[model samples]
Target: MLTAAIVAILVTMVLALIRAFLGPTEYDRMLAANAFGTKTVLLIALAGHALSWHSFLDVALLYAMVNFIGTIAVMRFFEYGNTRDNEGSGSTP
Candidate 1:
């Protein structure tokens, strides 16, 4: 069962990669990339179980957090042209 799940996830990840590369718009690619990351997390968990890896949970959780942060950073760049917020940009004292 776990093997089947891992295979399915890998298949979707490949599809996501294709979308990321062939997507017409950056937004579409970003979404695909995000999906790829999510699928990776699932794959990690499933594979860990199948392989009996004790540390898979920790690794998957960390990777998931990284994926979330990376997606947020990419969206911020698209929205603000940078990661840093320009608070109180009226004038610098």
Candidate 2:
């Protein structure tokens, strides 16, 4: 049962990767990437269960945190133009 679930998740991850590659807009790509990250977390958790390793959950939690932070950074970068030159540029007020 668990093996089947893991396989399904892997399939979803592959589809998400395809979407990330073929997305027409940056936001669409980001969304697909985020979905892949989320599925990765699930995959890790399932693998940990299948292998009887308790440490994988911790790794998954850390991955989730890092993924969330990266998504935020990407969104901010798109919104603010650039992290280093957002304040001093004379494009607008």
Each model's C-alpha lDDT?
A: 0.90, 0.93
Residue range 7-93, candidate 2, lDDT tens digits: 999999999999999999999999999999999999999999999997999999999999999999988877777656656776775
Please provide the root mean square deviation of candidate 1 (C-alpha atoms, Å): 4.5
Indicate the TM-score of model 2. 0.87
* Model 1, span 8-91: residue lDDT tens: 899999999999999999899999999999999998888888889999999999999999999999998887774244564665
Predicted structure 1: clash tally: 0
Error of 2 at 43 (Å): 0.3
